[model samples]
Target chain A: MINRPEPILMKGNEALAEGAIRAGCRFFAGYPITPQNEIPEYMARRMPEVGGVFVQAESEVAAINMVYGAAGAGVRAMTSSSSPGISLKQEGISYLAGAELPAVIANVVRGGPGLGGIQPAQSDYYQATRGGGHGDYRTPVLAPASVQEMYDFAGLAFDIADRYRNPVLILADGALGQMMEPVLLDATPREVLNVPKPWATTGMKDRAQNLINSIYLDPDELEQHNLNIQKKYRRIEQQEVRYEIILGDDADFFLVAYGTTARVCKDVALKARAKGMRVGLIRPITLWPFPSQVFDDLLEGKGNRQLKGSPKPFGFLTVEMSFGQMVDDVRLSVNGRAPVYFYGRTGGIVPSPREVLAEVEKIYAGGAGKPEKAGN
Target chain B: MTYEMLFAGFGGQGIMLMGTLLAYAGMIEGKKVSWIPSYGPEMRGGTANCSVVVSDEDVGCPIVTEPSVLVVMNEPSLQKFYNTVARPGNVFVNTSIIDPHHPALARLVGENGERKSQKEKGGGRAVMSENVSATEDESVIAGEGVRVFKIDANRIAQDLGNGRAANMVMLGTIREVTNVVEMASLESALQKAISKRHRDLMEINLKALHTGAEWVRSHDVPLLTPAG
Candidate 1:
């Protein structure tokens, strides 16, 4: 018989921290930020009990550098911050990526472009998926929509980081970071994946010293390193595309969203379906991979019977909490095959399901065959 | 069943705690629940609110835009959210701090679905003349089908000892009126929300809850089951 712990109500930040700890994360360093302070606070209280180290660094930059240092020594290290604080950690993130050190950085996003409000927003989609730092490097981004996903994805992020020897980011919004929900913790203990880091900078006794540096002074060597990094990113893109498709069998149109916005889109889909309009949702779990295959399949009329016989046209409505960021990727995937409409609310405003449904209805009322890009 | 509840009041009024307890109770009963507090920019002592959504199925959105039930523990919250309640819903007002006949509530209709003003109030209802007159059933129709529950929650808590448990009283009143969660589940949730260090305060809180429930029972308001 499998003994599982009962579900307990927990904030998303606390759950994510606990999930990381359970996955054998031992070192944490983070500066305080609104909507995500709970992560560091939880780590401060629980890390010592597990024989882990938690450091409240003086600044976001210092915290991320500390993570880089710890991860260099083969420790599963992590750091978290909000939007502005995350901006301060970009250089360190680039260093981690360039050095091929495994680490996790969580961003409980707030409004962007500057030191924006502390309210929830998805303005960081572009920054997260498209490498916020200055490099020819890409960090795999996991977007968790619910509190459960926030908990489950922490370990997954760490595992992905270690698997690729690259930094992995968990991109969440203020809402997902602050919300509380019940989560069932796995009671049975399991081994953390046995991935030995032979290249860790532990010691040089009886072995060649491991050099963990991103700067290659020779141009040829630098070019070769960049090529290897690009190859790894391509492999990750092929193998790590994650998304959820809901009610799309006969959907006449699809609403593409992620994170908290996707949850709202789910409700909008249900409401539209109840009114006899066939609506669906395509929620991208991996924002970096972007789940382009789902869009490709839908455009080919694979699942929906209506689109097959007569080539009935269908459109994609991309809803976000930012102004037309993810829509660009959706357009790239659609490749102008169908009209892609964009609807967004910015500056810390979370669009309501009613408002999003109105947008979907508007797109439905209009014929879905056009190939124009509708921007909002 | 899905219940979207919004609890709003001053920061120190335990508004967040009230919503958390409801969410916890719903989770204990094997329901999917989400609770989100408003962490926007605000000054100290400013109004605070939290939204809790409890559903038998998956919770689509944690933020409650149109609430099935709105609990206003102060005047500002009522002024802020009275109109946002869904039609055919319930709004619980703390009459100890909020005037039942305040100008902000002038547009709301009476319980019988008539637009009655303060001047149109008839004779011989158990009116709290010191404040606004308490209605016969202690409720007023706020919208076309929305019922407003007016209870002096502070006075009820004071009567039971410890006025700070007014939030608990309001919780019990809402529980009795809506039956959103079982009483046993609520008791367990209370234990979870409060810490073991302050376990001694549980007795008064339980008393406050019962007192609030008794107030609802003695007033004989209709059952306001949560909207789907």
Candidate 2:
């Protein structure tokens, strides 16, 4: 383990960069983009100091490919971009997943369908967890709410990527990337990772030349590869459903959210509790795993008998900084056991706590959320 | 206690710097801080502003819909945010650059102080008359009760040989009025926020802080006595 430095205040972007460096991320390739530009800026200055590599690639596509190259050489590598930039890297990310290469991609996402505004938005939930580019693939997406989480997740993304032999993502947004806060950055150096990858494509001098290509002309071989990836994903879903329950027990209703939206919902829950409303909150840390069991547990209770001071157990309100993406997962988890409702703000517009509370009140009063388009 | 403040001014007025320094000072005080800069085309020459929240507990969303304190360094900034300052909050209005006699301003002293010509009095309390008519915006501001500390922050900074230090003057006033962060920690934050090349201005900036705090102390003037 390395020395833990004194706690320093930093923007979320800078913290992620420092976390990557601390996690022994020796290679970083990324293009310059707003909100998340600080990641590349920090890496450019610090990577060389640690005898690592940092490149401001020509574009997002080139930058992601650079990450693929570095990861192929069995080195800790990373790349970061905002929404549009992440969109551009999806093809490369899909390839990374197919090849079973381990790499970290930090998506400090912004509002978007195409080159959307730079303000924070969690609209990329579907793009991140359900596969954005092509084919059968899933990226383990970790959402960070605070600057501290941004730092910790940067390292954790790399560790999980290597451990699972998959591409991992730090799925934060512009708010989490731009907002500044105090972060404790000391402890648990990257040497503890110590992931052995003899199968990695290093030099062929002492061992068999490892092939690192996604293209499998044989249909049966490709199908087998996909089945293997799916099996690993199932394992991840079973073992890595990280979430936090805020005042969940004995509460009447819950606000389901993630990342910055979760922070806002926490305020709403607290304010509602102050007003004698039994409101609780659920924050999903791993977006890819989706924490369906958490939802299932909350929805299932003694039938017909509601808890005191609360609505039905399954009557949960999903608040997202997007136009209702995660609510689909929430609804799926409930599966008619309990009612699921949603409130969201898209196009870089953040929902205030007051508005979210108002929506939750509506839900508690038997309002049903109009389900949106539900395909991947 | 959580203190949410908005520091606003022209693009070059060091408004963002003031907010950053406050957030950093909050960190020095062992408090949780979130600094959210208003990022858009509006920040160029328009009203550049940033919201800073210093809290003992974990901070929620960083955006300040209604700030508890406001440092308005320009007329546009004042006009833009006066209505959004929460009642019972504090406002430090920069009288140097803004027209105190501006018809729409809800001057703090007009109700209690003697009305004098703008030429005779450097401050603008005459607009307190609007507090009577109470336009919707003005009603939200003065009618709701706010301690308005009208200071010639620009003039004070100029007197200190750096007109740009007006933001610092406003910051000092915030420190005195809200006591959101410790004075010594603010000074340390100032040193860290300023670059080595501008280390020479550290003393003058500290002077600006003292200058603003002194102005607030002497204002024995009604900083807003919350409306009953």
Candidate 3:
């Protein structure tokens, strides 16, 4: 039996890189950018050591395209960047979604509308959750709050992506990327992965030529392809919604957040409880699936029935680092069963625990505004 | 309970290393721990700071804006972090370089004292500085209101043959004062956490740590109290 190694201190970016390697990621391509340079720098040194290929692409666009090429071969491949660079990779991501290829992408997000400060931010919430690139297709997104999550979810991302044949994104921030924590690598042994690629372009053999094409010229064919992709996504939604519920035993109000925002929300929950409030947290590990059913179940008094008859139990509050991007999803999940409120801090600024608690109080007092209906 | 600390200094002062060692010791003690370093632009020549959190329960927000303790190695670091420290929090200063009556602490006192409505009847205690003259003359009066402990970490590190070992020395002092970890466990953690390439330097670091701990114990400074 392989014993788990003792916990070692590691940065989030380094954990992501290690997770990729253990998840059978044999190909990596990336361009260096602030707050995310460590990912590429680490891969440059480590990939070769692990008998893998690491390429320093000229630009973010090129790096993502390289990821596209490697993913088409049905191999575990990845590329990473910050917000501005992620914007450059949007086209390639959309293409990967169109092609229905499996790959991993990491965005160690920084503050941004454009060329913003190099600090941790969740400003890309809308971009990641609503499909930043031009398409109706959605990629699986994983938001990790801690360095250990950075490692755990990175491996989970690869598996989920391959299982669905869809691109998976590790949505982190500068703080998560730069922070170091003791990570335990003992839960599961490194999975030995072999993605069979009969359709790969590793030079046509004696078998029938396999053509990997995203371009379906015929309108009917394109629609059929879209329908097929939708079917896969529907299957994923049915199977792969992951989240963590904290202190929900007697919770009357639920705080919905993800990534670094969730970490802060947890602290606020503690403070709220101390002040005689029944606040709990629902942290979605998977963003694309959105954990809608979990929210529905909780709101309908299915999960945590102890919270059922609380007199002052409010609805759910969606907290993020962006301006109400994830609030729409929270509203969609609740489907008007209970009030859905939003609180946010943008431009890479994180909300303090006091600010989050203040919002919770506002919602509890029936003062928070009703969530604007989404166009879905 | 959780103890959050910020170690601030110039880049070469091993502030980050000091935080890392504390975090390592916490890990050895089986507590949840996190160590976050300042990287990129602010780490070049400007003040560098790192936050370390150790808790029996799960750690919530690892980015500590108001730390329970501040370990400052330079005047700039002290200036940058003096105001953000929690009230009743300890501030460890390297008094060999920084003046006890630095302008930053004066500003902090002006703001905090006025805002908190502290009475001005008693003279405020200044941050303790090592009295070079007192070392020879032994007659100077030191104030007691503000808690401060003075140590010459550089001299100790130089005597240990590696100036960077000053970080470990500080770690030893923190361990002794805070009781976050025992000295033996910290030494073992240092041995395990450091890279194999630095194995040979372990003995020197061990010696420096003991020396620093002995310095703190021998000084009979009442300010070096345990973090309650």
- Using DockQ as the measure, which candidate wins? 1
**Could you give candidate 2's per-residue lDDT for residues A171-243 as a string of tens digits?**
9988888888888877555564879998877888978779889999999999998999999999888877788
**lDDT over C-alpha atoms for residue B131 of model 2:** 42
Tens-place lDDT per residue, model 3, B128-222, is 23211111111111222223445567767888898778776777776666677778778877787678998898888898889878776665444
Superposition TM-score, candidate 3 onto the true structure: 0.88
Second chain only: TM-score per model?
0.85, 0.83, 0.77
Where does model 2 sit among the CAPRI classes? medium
Lowest summed lDDT window (length 10), candidate 1 chain A:
A304-313
Candidate 2 clash pair list: A252-A310, B146-B224, B147-B223, B147-B224, B148-B224
- Model 3 CA deviation exceeding 4 Å by range: A1-4, A186-189, A193-195, A303-312, A362-376, B103-146, B156-164, B193-201, B219-228
How do the predictions measure up, each by TM-score? 0.93, 0.91, 0.88
Single-chain TM-score of chain A, each candidate = 0.95, 0.93, 0.93
> Residue by residue across B139-203, what tens digits does model 2's lDDT show?
12244476566677888899999988888888888898788998899999998889999999998
Q: What DockQ, on C-alphas, does every prediction get?
A: 0.81, 0.66, 0.59
DockQ, ranked from best to worst? 1, 2, 3
Point out the higher-scoring one by lDDT: 2 or 3: 2
In model 2, the number of clashes is 5
**Judged by DockQ relative to the true structure, which candidate is superior, 1 or 3?**
1
